[model samples]
Target: MTSRRTFLFKTLPAAGITLALARHVLAADPELAESDPDAMKLAYAADASKVDKTRNPTWATGQRCDTCELFNAPDGGDLGACSLFKGKMVRAAGWCNQYVP
Candidate 1:
């Protein structure tokens, strides 16, 4: 029988690899890649006046990148796959009129 320490050591690497592979597979979808272009444009256009007043009145309100569905910060908190653009990563500081939060 394997010692607890040895079992943990051996399983850790496999677990890590499995997680990495799963993330890679999820990110490889064409839909995620396709969302990048529009998201980038939205991020660039997140100015206070340009954002939808109904969704966001001030830049300090719901204009944060974390609130935008397309914002995909690599830090891995609220970031997720975007449905509008493809391949490119997004920042939490990013904002667009389409921002959900």
Candidate 2:
């Protein structure tokens, strides 16, 4: 029963609103900081290459969050959610004691 003009007016605004909300919801989460108490305890480094080899003998040269089993990377992006740090994102090149191949 709606006219073409009325439908356009209603649909355009609704579509725009939906797009805005979807973008907000899908926005990337904040990155985890190494200075956090939990991160410090686990020796989490934003860059795997920066991790101290002497302190963590288990760490290998190529280990990283992106390749780790605990990382939940969507679309193979550079940032992802790590099981070690809930609700925060980790860099693809990050490292932590909990990292698994």
Superposed on all Cα atoms, the candidates' RMSDs to the truth, in angstroms, are: 8.3, 3.7
TM-score result, candidate 1: 0.35
Candidate 2 regions with alpha-carbon error over 4 angstroms: 1-15, 18-27
Name the 10 consecutive residues with the lowest summed lDDT in model 2: 24-33
Model 1 weakest lDDT span, ten residues long: 28-37
Which tens-of-lDDT digit does each residue in 38-63 have in candidate 2? 88988999999999999998899889
TM-score for each of the candidates: 0.35, 0.76
**Model 1, CA-based lDDT:** 0.55
